[model samples]
Target: MAATSRPKLLAGRKVLLLADFQFEDLELMYPKMRLEEEGAEVSVMGAHPAGIKYTGKYGYPVKSDLCVDNMSTTDAVASYDALLIPGGFAPDYMRRNQAMLDLTVAMADAGRVVASICHGPWMLCSARRTDGSPLAKGIRATCFSACKDDLINAGAQRWWTASSCRAGGPFITARTPADLTPFLHAIIDEMAK
Candidate 1:
């Protein structure tokens, strides 16, 4: 009747990559590659069925590993140790999907780490889980600075403004693609714990 514990680091962790039409290419691929290098299994999730072709903000094409519709929400995402949301227009698209939001909420509630880059945190805001709540209320996290400012200037509330802010919960947000290395490291570290 004793509880079993998860492994340290991502020796055998499963990471869910969620995206839409246009996502930061480097931000998505780099972390996915890095996590795989560390013995983690990486899978792609998109709004389309046949699979989503990712485009950079500048319009360069990026290929995906799989489609969201190809796998069941309860199957593809349910067992992952973490969720990675790369920014760009993708998170915006993802925000509209109830299934994606539910998966994110479930991960955070389970105390699993959720890593996001660039405007990726926008999905967090859409999930309504970034409102200084117990899940991500004040954790030292960060996200794309200009985007955060734009949200504020546009009168949007519930966005993180710092370059790197952690809200004292399970969320980890970073400002840009340049923050990927550290952000992925942090996520790996958290999952390892």
Candidate 2:
């Protein structure tokens, strides 16, 4: 009998995940695990200082490997193949930092994978490219129903899709926690590419 093969589709790929206070527990954890299973290295960065623990809305906790402030160098940022932003109140807090927004824009401008789930899309709506263009502008997107208006106001085009819609760059988004499976799969697919 033939042995089953395990897929390490994202072997050698590095992914950066952004989180802060009140991140969605499942949104951050699910991707970290799933992506690792596929052989991707995932780094969690907090909007605050490094080494501090951040709690999710449901009270789950995650330690920050580094602060977003430390990802300043071109080489440091360039090492990542993709970025993941998990939803929750975290987006509301993370979105306030210029570094977080700049990082999002840089990842998108490079056409790398930029994925956000649920309220995570708030970062997408807030990021601005070097050209002064809104990151959400002219992109097909979907998010939590409450955020629908925010995206629209930010110039994002609405798309009804089961999984995710392409962002202003090589972006993807899911509407809620229920969509984590599909959202995680979308991130894997893009990173795999």
Candidate 3:
């Protein structure tokens, strides 16, 4: 029998990427490109408005096409199939923004796919469910070693140090820049389903 070809994994799906100043360059760009390659439409969303530009940790500038604060319509979170939070010092600042937290909570509560790497879980911890629960409370996750304490305190039950990536439910997390490959693959796998 002739083998049937498979369609693009994430065709017709939309993904939202959240970030702020000092985002890790590779973590954000790599997955964005990969997602596009798999036929997913990816939008870069920041803490501010569309005109705002965020510089990456290595000096790359990424301008936002969508902003958390600009999402006033009720269907904002419903428009995307998944949310990706790239790591770096950006997460530290992102976690402090009420609008950003609200967006994350909406995504998590809607059961949309969420992926975080390095320091990205900082936002996840802060912007959990709408009832103010921490998304990591009982989820297995991995982030930069420095974030272990905060992640646990924020309620991650098991913080994996030996693994580069962990996926629980609709959430996926990676340890560091070295794990970006597996991290993207995990997100792709999630979206494929």
Top candidate, metric lDDT: 3
- Which of the two candidates, 1 or 2, achieves a greater lDDT against the reference? 2
lDDT of 2 by residue, 1-193 (tens): 9989887999999989998988989999998998988999888998778889998889999998988887773654579999899888889988898988988888888778889888888898889877777788888888887888888888888673434544435878888878887777778877777
Candidate 3, which ten residues in sequence have the lowest lDDT sum?
A: 69-78
lDDT of 3: 0.87
Ordering by TM-score: 3, 2, 1
Q: What's the residue-level lDDT of 108 in candidate 3? A: 74
What ranges in model 3 sit over 4 Å off?
A: 1-6
Q: How far is candidate 3 from the true structure (C-alpha RMSD, Å)?
A: 3.0
Q: Which ten residues in a row have the lowest lDDT in candidate 1?
A: 130-139
Q: Candidate 1 regions off by >4 Å?
A: 1-9, 58-66, 69-78, 129-139, 149-167
* Poorest stretch of ten by lDDT in candidate 2: 160-169
| Candidate 3 lDDT over residue span 124-185, tens digit each | 78876756678778788889988888788878866568689999988899988999899999
lDDT of 2: 0.83
Residue 109, model 3: Cα distance from true site in angstroms: 1.2
